[model samples]
Target chain A: MTETQGLHIAVVGATGAVGQQMISTLEQRNLPIKKIIFLSSARSAGTKLTFKGEEIEVQEAKPESFEGIDIALFSAGGSVSKELAPEAVKRGAIVVDNTSAFRMDENVPLVVPEVNEADLKQHNGIIANPNCSTIQMVVALEPIRETYGLSKIVVSTYQAVSGAGAAAINELKEQARDLLDDKEIEPKILPVKGDEKHYQIAFNVIPQIDKFQDNGYTFEEMKMINETKKIMHMNDLPVAATCVRLPVVTGHSESVYIEVEKEGVSAHQIKDLMKTAPGVVLEDEPKQQIYPTPASSVGKNDVFVGRIRKDLDEDRGFHLWVVSDNLLKGAAWNSVQIAESLLKLGLVTVK
Target chain B: MTETQGLHIAVVGATGAVGQQMISTLEQRNLPIKKIIFLSSARSAGTKLTFKGEEIEVQEAKPESFEGIDIALFSAGGSVSKELAPEAVKRGAIVVDNTSAFRMDENVPLVVPEVNEADLKQHNGIIANPNCSTIQMVVALEPIRETYGLSKIVVSTYQAVSGAGAAAINELKEQARDLLDDKEIEPKILPVKGDEKHYQIAFNVIPQIDKFQDNGYTFEEMKMINETKKIMHMNDLPVAATCVRLPVVTGHSESVYIEVEKEGVSAHQIKDLMKTAPGVVLEDEPKQQIYPTPASSVGKNDVFVGRIRKDLDEDRGFHLWVVSDNLLKGAAWNSVQIAESLLKLGLVTVK
Candidate 1:
């Protein structure tokens, strides 16, 4: 192994939203670390953070910051990842990048650990995490694919505000207060902050989740469609996604309609299969009014599946209600799981 | 037209949540009502209400309350409607019932004036308002159905917390506050309050809108399926719904996937049809990331339709997004529109 009992792990963009969560997930899971380096943008370099009960100074996350680091995790932004991820890898540290910069890169392994753990073995220093919505969908759909071959996937997501980062979550809260007090407020940092206009997400549903792609589908929808095929190793898999933003803080719930290749499979059997799946907690009981929700799923790492049922006409088709803390299973947890997989596989030793 | 200028209008259960909206809608729309009679349960009888800058007293609803009333509106619970709507009709007052009690009854015409204004002439004293989800969908789909025959319909709704009534709305607010403030909160009024357990709606999606029926579809889903056919005058049309309650306050948004009988229909054609449809506002412009949002739709009577696209490889399949203020178009506005139609049709005559 790289080190006897500790590995020097540098967290790139450690002060940003998902960056902070990645740090927390690492510490909470009690990973073996010799040194925890907090790296942020140049403007945030003077900041301090408490890691494992000790105050650590944040450094600017440039290519040079990867020097002497074992594994560097990137979650700052797409531009930040595009610029610095390869630099960290060139410095002999494996990079688990959370941004979408390299996810669709043919050579890079877009890993969800549960779906493609073996995909990590061939990674050339950089491992890409799928989009938050795509991550949760693959976790729920992987077991099904293994048992019954998957043919088609149609998912409608009830995505959370935090997926847009910390600013959008704050916007949801502020707008809700302004609405309650009957005060006039303008929306900011939602449906896409860089887009022309923003919409209020406190008590609304935003049909657009990301920038509109050329095919009239939002970038988020295209991510799910593209990433699902890649993760399942089915380049010809039929996938359609309607990514919608809801007024939730943490958890992302999805209504997924999937068609399995096998015939005559019951919803009960699907429910049974998901009940014992890895990183899954089945909470479906329609009679007792029990199902998974974002509020209840906050702060948890498990991808929750509920409301399982077979489509009435299509005997091979089934519907699934999947939910998970978008920040956890969607981002930090999956990233951390990749790091954990790296450790166990001895693919990247901090030597 | 039944002595047009000002007529006596009676509102049953005038002290409840929806009743207040009904009262405000009547005043906001400037309906021609000379005198307004407010009726409620015994416990709410003595309550005072302000309408058009005047305070009216709410009296206990009785059969005699319909006497001398040109038209009566019912928003009391379904049981109260089942017992008292006939009584109001026996007293010669045309009842525009907002409860589910008579929506599916063969004798009662469930009407959304924009969709089935002609159905008003066939009503037998009791005119029923479709469910909140149903009303919005029919308003969006009715224009398309007229131009092209509809064969099969499937819908998955991201409903608001307000659809369960004001208490559920309050619960959502309270729980949101508690969750943001980091306090443990108990949910008591969601996913069917009368059912065994309650779930927090802040970050969750509860698939069961109403109680589960014997056929595995929840009552809310059945309402959409049955009520859509009844409103469209299509008895054998196939329809299915999966209604989910998201933590939104005012508007209900739905992801509707449908297969039409006509082949090679373009999304642009559907957009053109929706533009001229009554009570329909087209908010679709995917290039600039513009579409219908629930927060922007509150306090309006229009049903917002967007995200019109043809499913790839399925020439006859199309996907649409539908949204509306449930309290307005779903309940209050539809009820008031029905009342206005009754006055115009001479179905309600002053004694």
Candidate 2:
């Protein structure tokens, strides 16, 4: 290939929030792309998006849209991925699916690049991007898990409304205005839009993110639990998650309680380990009153961690506060990073 | 003394946030107070606030402000309470301090009436209100602690900007607007105003609420840790807190991981117990997509509990998602409740 003769790239669901970020991430990273195909539903087919100073008209994504595409990034709904991902792969594209569609499939490789990029080699023609919360988490913890044998993890998240979609972010803004104006506020798009009930997100938190499974854990929480095990290569890693939606627009913060196999480990030691870990930013300085905040983390790709302290009772337990821009490190950036990895490792050849 | 006689009252630092709430709370609850003496700093003297539709002028608070006052509610800064609580006490007014100035004092009684009302009998003229997070957590967990037997608690808080003060709330709003408008966002009045630097609370979760102590716990986290024990009357109870500020304006939500002293209790059993708990509303049905949201709990006084689940690995451990309006149950209503307890228990009488 010539110096700038790049791979042909296609982005499924290019009109959505995460899909837009995926397109931007690809542009910002400059991952050797020669041609770009933007796909959305038929309703959004004529939508125009500018990347690298060129206005690209989005096309209606059908199975035929994947023809000659070297790499396809699918971020439509899960159902869309369920139908379109295989078609893209069959048409000679290596698909990086961003939906929950291929995530739990035993054959599809789930990649964080920083955590489990090697899993990409095992991809059955399609790769899975883990949930936003799980992707940021395992990125921070996997390094520590390798150095210090792991036991258990319990995490409660402070997530931004943007994770739900642009509509939810708009809803939070609308409701906050109504709340402050002493006007009646109503809910239309939170907890789960498909679920029967909805709650306002303004000045509040909703505990349920995705719908609840039979196990009582919301689908969002179970995604964290199962996805963490898969990404960390530890199905028996004793993980628990409480996923919550806050009024933030981007970024996700997590209070993680961890039990390592090693005993008598001080919080400072773990923090030091995180300081050197890849894709992690350690901001734990108690004396100067330094720590991470989601607002400060917006648009940043690194996972910011602080508030590390040993558990008061459990000698083997430790606690950490993890924060990151959910759209960046959690989704779009992770996908871009995986594409970079695929290129760097010479795992994919342009047809 | 006749039962219908109005009771004399003093409102210390009446111009502040919680103090303003105290005034409105009394009006809302229709407490029959004979008089309200509005006291504040010398700078705030001559200000007027309407109470019960009457224009009450604030006067500079001095040692004599408590003279002939029956019940004094203080929400001034801690220094004011430190210099003036005893002065108010010596002048015969019963002081309900909303500052940490007197909390944890061996001679003073820290009371959350629902959790430990009888302790009011030992009060030496000062009843300390618990921290906002602690008050809400104890309100939700105290009943569970009583029925299930308490052992350990791990809480992660999604706090409101109002908890920092009215100025912080304004800062959060303005910063959000600036971010949306692509203007330069200034950071002030957040992550501890007294610290050397400030961070924006818009679209952010700052882990540090107060200045960090030597112990690495932000004063806010330490407050949740320490106040929870004193309120629940369990000094040895293992409690850890990760206090974070979201862009919220009023309510706070906590993800509480608790280990019960008893074993083999299902999540359903705990949900059943909390559904009937006093001062609590259980909104924990996952099937119908019903769960507590912070926006829904804003104007209410009761703590809302939901997202109850037993930890998959630890039969003794369970998770609870608790939410309450910090300005209400966490502060104003809680303070007002203490005053009502004093009046009902015949602990306060006009001179």
Candidate 3:
């Protein structure tokens, strides 16, 4: 196939929540795709999804499914990615894995296009997408870090339920409805979906996100800490994160406190940098009462940053509120953007 | 009247959210009271409320309302407290002001009974209850500080809408219903109820809890920062806060990062301290997926502390998850406890 003929794109887990978003994002994005294929797990296979006004049939993803696929986007789960990602790569497919399976892999380059697109060039067949919370944060901080220099980061996330999967979203909705109706809620999915104890998310905040590691940080918090360092290429940046799941269903909001290397950096200067930063929207205007909220950031692709303020006692420290659609910018849109970057950077070739 | 006759008690803003909680807390506590009077602004006056199986009519609160009141709890708005708190104090009542009006007053002691009940003895007449967010954090950290000594504190709050007031709770409920029904939401209250712009709180997180100050910190955030230093009686403590309002209706949650003066203090030691700390319930067992959450903390009068872990890079820094009912331990219960402390300390006397 000629370069002008575009490339074949396959979306693994196309029947899932983030997968549907990947299809929609692919349709909306200016990616040159000659063919689009939808693939899901055997349980969800045979489902039909729409792509660019055409109904696409989803087949069970397998090793053979990656044949002739130029780029494959995977978000099924870590197990699926661990099993099939290597298979796809073996078949010459450029895989953009949106799971934690390969995020910390030394051979894999975790790409948040705006923050580390050039890192995509070093990809060895598979590119890892950073965690949803890390994607929005790194995008917002990259500009500030680039200008002010960076030393440390402490983030507390007010994350949405959709990050846990579509089932968790349904649990949030049903639980909320049951609560409003004064019915007893049976929580089967939340915090850690497969954990022994499930807590009600209706009008609640769960401090645990993902399972706890031996170090006492949840896997989600570790992802934010580790993946951020990997993407920023700062191994010793001194990052700490506290990840919490809120009742919100879509956008993920983070309260990030970062210490810059430069002294005497003002919040006004940081806001000015964010205004022109790629894939970043500066939404701070205290007098006008303008700032980003999860509901307002829903369906948006750009990371919204606001509430910029210097730390009260630390002149080099600044705080930011970063928000984005967890399904879009955090997962699907970021995955699709990685594919676009691969094509732009000549990391993917049409066969 | 004999000292054994007990003291008359008055609850200002009786018809409001926190005021109702104050009445309930008073009924539950074994405080010696000759009579309980409910009072509100003229707008909310005449509302009927039940306390200890008896219905009481709310009267228009005036200076005369505190004529013989031994303890008066004020939680109306800042303006109401500003106008009536002094009035209550002048008429022989030891006022427990819940609004921000008198919190910073040199003559008024900002008291969190669990942290600084002794400060209650220094109250000129008005004893200020710290902000809900500040109250919970100080309760959780005071124990640690007593053992290890604290040098710095950085907190990010996931506060409930009820902290904004009764109308804000209504807004959250209505907005949730509207969103669930696929109807357009009109947010009339939240962040700051009477602010120029109102944002939807249903399935959303608003970073601004109160009106933004000139320094870009919200009044709620400033309270957490300033009151923390005062309540802990540390004049040179480095404190920074980022307070955000969540859609939860009752409990407020905080992700706090604190640095202890002593090195080699493990998270296990902190958990052990919290397990025995007064008014603190430790719910931290990562293996059991146990942690304090807002929903679980509702209706409880103690600060629930969990998710205790060491900062990845800062050996002296530890992180904690603190949750408490915004109206209970954060406001009304704290007020009632302060009043109890007053009687225990002989700060209040019947004449």
Give lDDT per model, in order. Answer: 0.86, 0.85, 0.89
**What is the lDDT for A224 in model 2?**
93
RMSD values, in order shown: 2.7, 2.4, 1.8
Docking class of 2: medium
Fnat for candidate 2 (0 to 1): 0.70
Cα lDDT of model 1 by residue, A17-123, tens digit: 88888988987886688877888888999799987788889998888888878788889898998898889889888999998999999999999998899999989
Question: Which should have the higher DockQ, number 1 or number 3?
Answer: 3
Task: Give lDDT tens digits, candidate 2, residues A1-351.
Answer: 222578888898899999989988887785887788999999999999987888999999999999989889888889999888998889988998888998999999999998888888887789998999998888788877988889999999988888888899889878776666678977998877888888877766788888899988988999999999988888888888999888788889899998899888888889889989999999888787677878778888899998888887678888898889888888888888888888888887644
TM-score top scorer: 3
Candidate 1 residue spans exceeding 4 A from truth = A1-6, B1-8, B28-35, B50-55, B178-184, B202-206, B234-238, B343-351
Model 1: per-residue Cα lDDT over B103-126, one tens digit each? 888989999998887788998889
Residue pairs that clash (backbone atoms under 3 angstroms), model 1? A293-B204, A294-B203, A294-B204, A295-B203
Superposed model 2: Cα runs more than 4 Å off: A1-6, A50-55, A176-186, B1-6, B30-32, B349-351
DockQ of each: 0.52, 0.61, 0.86
Where does candidate 3 clash, by residue pair?
none
Residue-wise C-alpha lDDT for candidate 2, range B66-137, written one tens digit per residue: 888878888888999999989989998788988888888988888888888888889888889888889988
lDDT of 3 by residue, B13-110 (tens): 88888988998888888887778889998998888888778788899999888898889988888898889888888888888898989888888899
- Over 4 Å off in model 3, which ranges? A1-4, B1-4
Pairs that clash in candidate 2: A295-B204, B7-B34
